[model samples]
Target: MAASSSRSFAEVQRRVSGVHRGTDPEQQLRFYDGWAPEYEQDVTILHYQAPRLAASCLASAIQGPLADALVLDVACGTGLVAQELQAKGFCRFHGLDGSQGMLESARRKGLYQELKQCVLGQEALPASSGFYDAVLIVGALSEGQVPTSVVPELLRVAKPGGFLCLTTRSNRSNLRYKSQMQQLLDDLEQRGLWEKVKVQEVERWERATSEQEAMEGSDYISGVVYLYRKAQTVGF
Candidate 1:
């Protein structure tokens, strides 16, 4: 193993973990803006797989031609998820995020046809109900980021018969958040909002070999990708 590679990975992991521990919006946005230039590089070092996992899951479940579908990617930092989806035959993409720096980097990739700025959970989403054929929000459904309440907004943007995909980490620190998210999904299902399409529990979500995270019994973190199909006859 290279010494320089290991040192660089550790530094990125520490910063990534630190970003999740705070509840300050401005501070988090500033941190991401500063980290935007090297963000893709750092996540690649972490072996982040949520974007790939989410795209694969959504692609397999969609019934129509992916190229004809319009996708809305929320919290689309650097267009990673859109890039993954585009590889799976999805062509049209619209993205939203809170960071201008990150969106600028994403624009250079040419994945999204439109990119808008919105502070999720606080600001109203700038989309009509049932507008998109597919709605995706990867890597932003965590506790210190977008609140669990935003899940409904994700559901709202999708067409009545469209798909909704979301991903989140499942580490020791996120136990309560995960539980709450699960409960919300269950309640929405019971209320006839959307039915589950698939739920994939990912074991190798990322490589965070830091001593603090390793105490969870492994050098890696786990995550889950949840896919749902909205009801065609009713809105919930």
Candidate 2:
């Protein structure tokens, strides 16, 4: 029993290390393309918990209904959360990510009215300013995945009063990443870029029913969620 437990802990640590190492845009795109098909399946059996929890936390942050609203799913990956939003009644939807291969899988879902390839951190938003009513970013905030610099750009494209919701793995104990994200949010708030509306951390757990599922789910290291809202214009 002791030997088995030690092996399990080591496997979990290895997977966590891989995610913490981060990846460049090109590498991320390539990785996602190769990972798209297996990604959803793996998430469904083992990885579904985080995205579902994050999306639920996001939904709770909004104040009003989103029936007629236009939403942007940044780094949408395979549109997992976008599909969830749509099913909940959001009509107009757009999904943007750097991985064409991932987008290919998202396109098949027939959810987004628009789907574009965007390299996070460097790629300019394809839409015009104030075009979306809300922007939902799930599993995007990280060290190498998305630079802190992108927060301002995200605020720029959202309409005043619109939502700019995002989730980042909780790094409260990791001062470096925590300070990086806090500073980014502070800069945006100081510039009147967006209002600090809601910020919360959620814990996530994964359980596996099969050996294959257990192997894939074993990779998740730390899981937490954060959200923010873009301030509405003063006087309407």
- lDDT of each residue in 1-236, candidate 1, tens digit only: 00123338767867787678756877777777887888887888888899989999999988879999999999998899998998899999999998888899889889899999888888778998989999999998887887888888988888999999999888767778889999999998998989998999988898865665553667788899999999896553
Cα lDDT of model 2 by residue, 112-210, tens digit:
999999887887788887777788777767666777777767777787887777766544323366578788888778867677766665444444333
TM-score: model 1 vs. ground truth: 0.94
For every model shown, what is its TM-score relative to the native structure? 0.94, 0.78
Alpha carbon lDDT of residue 221, candidate 1?
84
Model 2 bad stretches (over 4 Å) = 1-20, 61-64, 171-175, 205-222, 234-236
Residue 65 displacement (Å), model 1 = 1.1
Give Cα-based local distance difference scores for all models. Answer: 0.85, 0.67
- What C-alpha lDDT does candidate 2 achieve relative to the native structure? 0.67
